[model samples]
Target: MLHPILPLILFAFVATATPGIATTLSTASGAQFGFRRSVPLMIGSAAGLATVTGAAAAGLAGLLLAMPSLQLAMKIAGSLYLLWLALKIGRAGPPNLDVTMAKPNSFFGGAGIQWMNPKGWAMGLGAAASFAALADGPGQLALLLGSTFGLTAAVSLSLWCVAGMVLARLLKTEWQWRALNIVLALVLAASIIPMWRTV
Candidate 1:
């Protein structure tokens, strides 16, 4: 049996390190909306991840993983969506940089994105299987997976927020921030190609 804690640790590290749409959006939100507004978005992202991982633990992910064509289709669609997001982010105008103008909808929006995210589903399924296989009991496995995912979300979102804050601090002008956003967007878009190939 695999060590339950081991899988949890793996999942946490993997989720935290992976730079996905959620991370980019969260960073943007933190930079544009401030930490308070970004919190909701972070919560939403976490919720979505938990939903998918829980589904994987329930074995739904197996059905998806079983079909190569379906998996391929999902990968393509996810990659395309990510590219679109990157483009949109790149083209967006600079924000007013006022926290009071911050839109909280971004948090829930990110959460919704996680549900349809191929990367998220793949990670969730892998973690679920790994945990289920090594767990001595269902309860222990659940606990481990939950804790891992929760911690991953917290750490990942915080890092994104910090990145945004750092950028905001460094770039004082609207044009500078706009330019940075474009770079961020392009970097995100470029990552999709490699990830798609790997998938």
Candidate 2:
């Protein structure tokens, strides 16, 4: 029981810390708008992940899994949204850097991405399932999982954003900036494919 509980925390940390859609968005936002402006994105993403964890403990993740069609629909929807975001990120750079021209990714946008992603759903469900420490109470499970993921997500995403900020300093020209954005956008788009490959 102790082993299971301890491992779950490590799982949550590593899973959230791994670069994914949310972190990609954070990186792009940090590069484009700097850390202060990217704070909302970080917070929103963490909130969104917390929601997913709580809902999984609440049983919505089981409902999604029981209905394959609904799950597929969600995956498709999330992928489409990410693709659209990738396009927007790719197109935005120094020429499009005017804050008025292209505002940073918003709080809601970050949350929405988490809500829609299959990877998030999968992680939530996995964490919520049959853990010994949480055997006596679902509420306890949700609280623990949500809090763990949320904290890990915030720290992980902020690091990625900081990495993006650091990368920004290396860009000596508009073209370099644009190229970096394009590369990030491409990686973000590519990230979606792995979740579906197993399906």
Per-residue lDDT of model 2, residues 1-199, tens digit only: 5565677777877898787888899888888888998998899999999999878876788888889898788889989989998888888766345443277777888888888887787788878774535656777777888887888899999999999898887887988988987898999999998768633
Please report, as a residue range, the 10-residue window in candidate 1 with the lowest summed lDDT: 97-106
> How high is the CA lDDT of each candidate model?
0.70, 0.82
**Superposition error at 110 for model 2 (Å):** 0.8
lDDT of 1 by residue, 1-199 (tens): 4553664676576775577677777787777767887888788888777776666666667787678788687677767777776766676655675333335445556666666666666776677666676556655555556556866887788788888888878887878977987887887787666545545
Candidate 1 regions exceeding 4 Å error are 1-7, 68-73, 97-105, 133-143
**Runs in model 2 with CA error above 4 Å?**
1-6, 95-101, 130-132
